[model samples]
Target chain A: MSELTGYLRTDGRKGIRNVVAVAYLVECAHHVAREIAWPHRDRAHVIGFPGCFPNAYAQQMMERLCTHPNVGAVLLVSLGCESFNRYALEKVIRDSGRPVKSLVIQRDGGTRATIRDGQAWIESTVAALAEAPRVPMDVSELVVGTVCGGSDGTSGLSGNPAAGRAFDRLVEAGAACIFEETGELIGCEEIMAARARTPELGDELRAAVAKAARYYATLGYGSFAAGNADGGLTTIEEKSLGAYAKSGASQIAGLIKPGDLPPRGGLYLMDVVPDGEVRFGFPNISDNAEIVEMMASGAHLSLFVTGRGSVVGSALAPVIKIAANPHMYERLAEDMDVNAGRIITGAASLDEVGEEIYRLVLDVAAGAETRSEALGHAEFILTYKSFEPIGPACLPA
Target chain B: MTTTDTRLLLLSDADNVLVARATIEAGETIVVSGTPITLPARVIMGHKLARRTIPAGTPVHKYGAPIGTATEDIAVGEHVHLHNLKSNYTATHSLDAARAGAEGQEP
Candidate 1:
């Protein structure tokens, strides 16, 4: 493998993309922050929490996102009265050796003045980040995440397994690969548990999925969507089985929650379901929420597999969309990066497509713009949630 | 037109349903497990089709696991979709209704 160059952070982490994040503390400030990012869409991205009330999970997630390796600087836009701790978030970013500035609308005059000030700050940050030193990074330094959205029957047969194949190769090459959505993995818990590195970890895996099952049962809904059924997926378990294919064949290293970085490079399962009673509505309200959590765990880039077709990108990291159904790929060719549907059509084998996805990862890491990035799909979202810290066994020894 | 040998994918030997890699028209002949059967209805690409006779209330296997229970008897080559099958976990809301709700019909 060739050496890849990335922006070197003072904390010894490397960023594949040095992005200037414009974050709004509440929904009130979202418009101004978004206006600031609209012109410099390629260099700056908008990310924030919409709630006026305080949420520890949201705060922790924002802190992690601001300090994410991909982020070189942060511009916080606060409406001046929201409960989010802007001071603490700024301190965390500054502690990571990245430039951070917070603009409060109430204190800074109004919307027009705040937008102008935020835009000016964003420009300078981008310019300064352009001068940041670039250092050679290894595959082991890369944290990659995989997720499936708009899934169909073909997702498991093609896109997901192809992503799994790529994940297996990346894991073998000593890269950290993460797969998430415990609620979606309910039916395949037994099979997935068997792939855990140790028996205790396997038990943890089963228990996590069991908790997800119970939580969803209480809500009277599965993560399974109406579109999932329209695309020939019958049940949540079937979707879980399909979603499970993205883990590849490697022994799962450990399980981690959102914002918990993997100890070392290998396959890790992200337990996204909270620890207590069903509190946060549905864990992940949407696909972007899942992507945000993965980014919180330090994923440099994400591989998003879709059969019904999804066109979503992240604020901190880039997303590579892999199309599973040949028909959907035909319809949404401009949005997809990899056409895993060829595996089903016999035009390409799984290994061939898998290698294509793997090479694309390296290429994207090397500064190639994903289709979503080029088209400017920097979608971000954070919501209310609660979680008890993960147990020690969750991380590999 | 492609034959079933190229257009249908059997995920595993244990799977009782085959995924349609491409759209298969009604009356099209499909071979599964060395037996040739004519499709009873058009199966859309990415959808499932019964590879063997599945009686009503029997678990329908795809990817080698039960995806759902058949609501009615499904013959070989019959399309297995929402009409004849349902999720074992929860009642699936219709896409049209969900879309309507999403577009401010409920709020």
Candidate 2:
């Protein structure tokens, strides 16, 4: 058994970091939330929805994020006019047995009062969190997520495949590993479906990818970014193949939406695309949005593979940045945690890099700071979207 | 998987393109599939080159998967990018028009 330990939550889930989440319910309350967490930024983080309109998806995501294993306490900051049911969110966090307090700009005075009150709450909460019980946590109890951003040709040949190998190792150790966004896995549906744990789940996998293809076709744009082309990725298909490499070669145990936690330890596919005619402009407005969705699904930490380089980290869960390009790694070494780029430079093999990533995951879980985390990069974003409850085929008993 | 001071990597035997393991200059020559071809232009690291002469409309392979079809007859050592390669599903988005705006293409 591994010797790592974490903060044990009331739900029996363990947290690698006991983060005090200062959440803004709407855009108007964002400034107050940021100011509250700004001083105690090391222990407290700011996260929120900018939407003035009510969205069930946003509400559910907020609830899941507030009660995520990594979070110790939550402070909700609301503008008192947003449609986002802040009371319902506060109730959920309170029900989860965490110390939750709310400050409405209208009810609890304006920005100055709210910021003063919120900062006081975070201070007490951080001190209280220090007394939280440290319980034994195993690698098998971990939930790991991976997303590739700023991708290029070498991403597939080096970092991505190496990440896949790492995923294989994680799954082998009985950890729940999730790889996602059917939009990015467009061209690999056939190959991905073939690796499903069940034949029925395979069909669900194919339909999810097909739905993504249709969704993007209607929008007139794939997830391809302009930086992708400059990084030497030619088409969405090519990029899809590279992105799909992060999943590794393992039997996909289940399929899930943004907030659906995996029932067991195995590989899962997260469908970030919204259900019913794509009303949302894009499935994920930014890469951080994707990481937020993974956090909602209970990912304790994330492995971000980037070829062109991305310096983003998540609020609740720590994000481990894996540099895919040797040249890019050399330039962004301070921002990077693992160098899968060594595979490209012939300094290491895929398995060697993969092993390095696995060890780093454990080390980070044991309280070692990632480069992004060390630099205080706690980026987060959430938006409106809807999803039908996952079907039975999604999780096989 | 061999990378002993190599400038190019042929990811799969089924692939018709070779990826630059490191940036290669225009005058550089590399052997591929037992045939030597001089680089027609500087190939940046993580960029692709036609490993063999790819006929127009043929699928381009990388990582042993079909990435997209070639839009023109690409010669060996020619840089394979958006100029000659197009996605079969949808058009790849680029900010060229905004760059055209840089060239004063927009008012």
Candidate 3:
């Protein structure tokens, strides 16, 4: 295996992409932050929460994202009166040995001046990050995540299983692979639980899906969309069966919540559903929210499998799109990176596509831009959700 | 045994449906379980086709697991979709209702 070079962080994590993240503390300061990041589009990304209400989960998510290994520096754009803990967020990023700065719009003479100052800070930060030393990084040191969206029937048979094969290869190589969206894994709970490394972990995996089913039930939906039905998926269970294929056939190492890094390198399930009553409308309101959760868990990049096609990339980590439906792939060829749909067409076998995905992952980690990245699709979203920490059994020492 | 033809695929031995690898128009004849049956309706690519006669209320098996329960008797080669199958997890939220709900309208 060949080695790849990455930016080394004080937290002992190696980042494939070193980004200067300009985060708006509230929606009020979004435009100013966006203006500041507009010029440094290649190396700087804009991310933030829209709500002004103080949400512990949102705050924690921001903190985790700011300190993410991929982030080399951070600029906080605060609206002065928002309840977000800018000082604490800045402190976390600073402690991570990354350059950190905060610009309060109200204190900095409003939009124009704040934008100027934020732009100046971003420029300086990017310059400083450019000089950051690169070190040899191992595949085992990487954290990869998988999610399926806009899925159709062909997704399970093609894109999802092909991604699963890639996941299996990564896991066998000692990489930490994560597959989530318990809401989509409703019917495959029994089969998924059977792959757990421990009986307790199996129970945890089963309970997570059960929670998702009950949660979606109260919401009067099963995470099934009309497009899914239009794509020939008859039920949520069928969709779940396809969605579960992304995990491959590796033994699930543990169950984790957002912001909880894997204890060791192996396959893990991210329990995204919030604990307690369904206060939040849905566990994941959109595809990006699931991507955000995966990013918080320290994923370096995410493999997004889509059948109907989705053109989304993350603010921090790059997103690799694997097209499932051959027809959709042809229609959205510009947005997709891998043609997993070829499996169904018999032009390529699952293992061939799997190897292609694996090679693309390494290439992307080595600085090859994914189709989403090339298209400048840096979509990010965060919302309110609550969760109790994982039990010791969830991640054995 | 699996078919060498790319137009249709049987995912597993336990699956009662064969997924259409390509669109099969109405009146098209396809072989399933070594028996030829004419498609009763158009089956879009990625859609399922009944492999055998199934009774209503019987759990629909795909990938060797029950995906949903059939709501009406399904004959071989008929399209297996929402019209005759219902999810066992949540009550059927029709395409219109789902679209309306996604757009913030009560359905």
In candidate 1 chain A, what residue range of length 10 has the lowest lDDT sum?
A: A226-235
TM-score of chain B of each: 0.73, 0.77, 0.76
What's the CA error at residue A356 for candidate 2, in Å? Answer: 0.5
Clashing pairs in 1: none
Worst 10 residues of 2 chain A by lDDT: A225-234
- Computed on alpha carbons, the lDDT of every model, listed in order, comes to 0.87, 0.89, 0.89
Residue A248's lDDT in candidate 1: 93
RMSD of each candidate relative to the true structure = 3.6, 3.1, 3.2
lDDT of 2 by residue, A1-397 (tens): 5888999888888999998999999999999899999989989999999999999999999999999999999999999988999889999999999989989998888889888998888888898888877889999999999999988778888889989998999999999999998899888988999999899999999999999999999999999998788778889989999899899999999999998988889999999888898797888988999999999999999999999889998898999999999888888999999988889889999999998999999999989999999999999989888999889998888
TM-score of chain A of each: 0.99, 0.99, 0.99
Residues A1-397, candidate 3: write the lDDT tens digits. 7568899998899899999999999999999999999999889999999889898889889999998989999999999999998988988888898888899999999999998998888888888888888899989988999999988888999999999999999999899999999988988999998998888989999999999989999999888777888788889999989999999999999999998988789999999999888896888988999999999999999999999898898899999999999999998999999999899888999999999999889999888999999999999999889999888778855
Please provide, for model 1 over A79-188, each residue's C-alpha lDDT reduced to its tens digit, 9 standing for 90 to 100: 99999999999999998988888999999999999989988888887888888888899988899999999998789989999999999999998999999999999888
Please name the candidate that would achieve the greatest DockQ relative to the true structure.
Answer: 2
TM-score of each: 0.94, 0.96, 0.96
